[model samples]
Target: MGLQTQLRRAIAVYRFVALGYPVLLGALAFDALQRPVAAAALVALLIGWTAAVSYRYTRNGYEPKVVYTDLAVTAAAVALSAWALAVSDRAWPISLGPWLAGIVLVWGAAWGRRSGAVAGGVIAVFGMVFRGGINENTVNEAALLVLTGFTMGHLVRLGVEAEERTRRATERDAAARERERLARDIHDSVLQVLALVQRRGNEIGGEAAELGRLAGRQEEALRALISSEAYRHPLDGRRDLRELIGRHAGESVTVAAPATPVRLPTATAQEVAAAVASAVDNVREHCPDGTRVWLLVEDDGEAVTVSVRDDGPGIAPGRLAAAAAEGRLGVAQSIEGRVRELGGTVQVVSGPGQGTEIEMRVPRPREGDADGDAHRGR
Candidate 1:
């Protein structure tokens, strides 16, 4: 248990013992006033014993041994009260109050609700037997005491469960936020560097060219992994797709979009942008110098689509799928894999002689879909 919980338990034990002090003093004074020397001595001894038990409880930090000590003290108090009742002529109903209160304190600490109820039941039975009859006042008081202990114990348990749930929720939220932040950093920095290497490979002839091509392919695979739903950033804020694409468009690259906004899910938008960027990189590497690339963004009612077409040598039959299998999978893995994850389809209408037309279609997410909520919340 936590230090705070231990301290609270200690405080509860001390409070119960302290509450007995006034009752003990009152019992002794009543016995003495009635000229019952033996009864007064018994009450005095009970007070001293309770005080010693309380002291030991404080010293031991309210350990399990305190429960044994409490039982012993309660037994002595009950026996003394029974003896006093036998000797006293004046019906001393109030004399049983201290012993009953001690039972409440002991059972409340030891076994909680069930034992407290049992203790209360025992006290009620004793009251009826000793007094020789049950009265309205006795029943009402007994019911109130038992209910009070039960309510207190139930509330304590509820508070503990609520606190634990809150702690777990806070931890999960923190972890998600951290993952989102890391995703943003990777997308902005490392992905950009890899794209640059891929584009510059054509300019640097020979072995350096081959190295550049290899780096470019690796970059595409990395982008594919990042665009997957598993790596999507949760904190992706509202972004203008046209503006993001325009920012990356160079002199040779041409970006075309509708005059109106093409709002897309955060994950979809990021993947589309990444795919467009990769397509442009391929044109820069394979096509003749200064080849023009066109990017078109179309927003249909039910879905959003992006088309990246190039006036360059198109992909050969089975080449895209074969490249993906051989780990040379840039377009297939990054662009196609990303669209598929979003419950969308990627169509590559390309062949030798005819220019390549890469179209990506992502359907709108439904109300309660996990991916939809994830992008919307971001």
Candidate 2:
């Protein structure tokens, strides 16, 4: 549908047409050398067929049906060549042209190496049968044709694969640019206003103070959401679990993690971090003032688990389901969504008048897993 795609189809059609020219020439030559009257008539017929097929293909814009018709034409040409070789005295040499032409057809069509190899084998068999013996020159010609066909076919296949990869890369780059643009626009306009409101409300007491606190919380969440660092660039240096948790700890918040490093995918780490932050925010919102929050990270080799617990009022029965129904979907979208996207799971244990505990478990990469490098490349 795109210009490049249309061009590629046109190129394929042209290659198909161009390949037939040599076969047509060889067919006419064979007829002239062996049957003069038939040679003239066959040449006329070839011209007419070629013109008709070309017109149909050009008009159809290289539809699959039109392409198949061209393939039928090639098959007919191959049949005609075989018939001529069977009847002619100089069948051995004359057959080589058609064999080479068949190889060209297979290669130009972008069939894989196996298809070309199969064509080579069939032609070689016919050559040996027609000549009644294998000679050095015949064997050499066969080998050359086979190699040429295989190489050309592979080259075409590689070109197609490379083109496809380029197209996907282009699309991905475009999408990334769009996301970055949206992030910038949100930060410039909405985030700036939120920040101003939060700061102003903090100065003015009463209802404005409550609004300011809410604005501040929202601003923090938005900042975390839009921060490129939170996305965890693969090329950036890795951080140990202890260091990562410590960075988020506060005077009222205690972090407990293993001393040793727990390697993880960048995405996995970021999601876990965001989930921890969300859990912390929820505890602050629902718990008694000045209640302590504890963060724990455990690395069990097979999986890494992170838990955020607060001795605060826990969720009531059916509260989560009710919240979801009411479109209060922050926890579901922010925490659960993040964990699920990383191929991990999240569990919440809570009850009315009790404490809340949020646990997230992410599977560890196996030894020598290719995904280790994939994370490093993120």
Best by the lDDT measure:
2
Model 1 Cα shift for residue 120 (angstroms): 3.0
* TM-scores, all models, native as reference: 0.44, 0.65
Q: Highest TM-score: which candidate?
A: 2
What would the per-residue lDDT of candidate 2 be over residues 91-129, giving only the tens digit for each residue?
343343532444343433334565555556555555555
Which lDDT tens digits does candidate 1 get at residues 101-158?
5545445444455555655665655555555456775676578557655654455445
What's the distance in Å from true for residue 53, model 2?
9.0
TM-score of 2: 0.65
Span of ten consecutive residues with least summed lDDT in model 1: 369-378
lDDT of each: 0.62, 0.63
Compute the lDDT for candidate 2.
0.63
lDDT of model 2, residue 277 = 78
- Return the lDDT, model 2, position 374: 19
Clashes of 2: 1
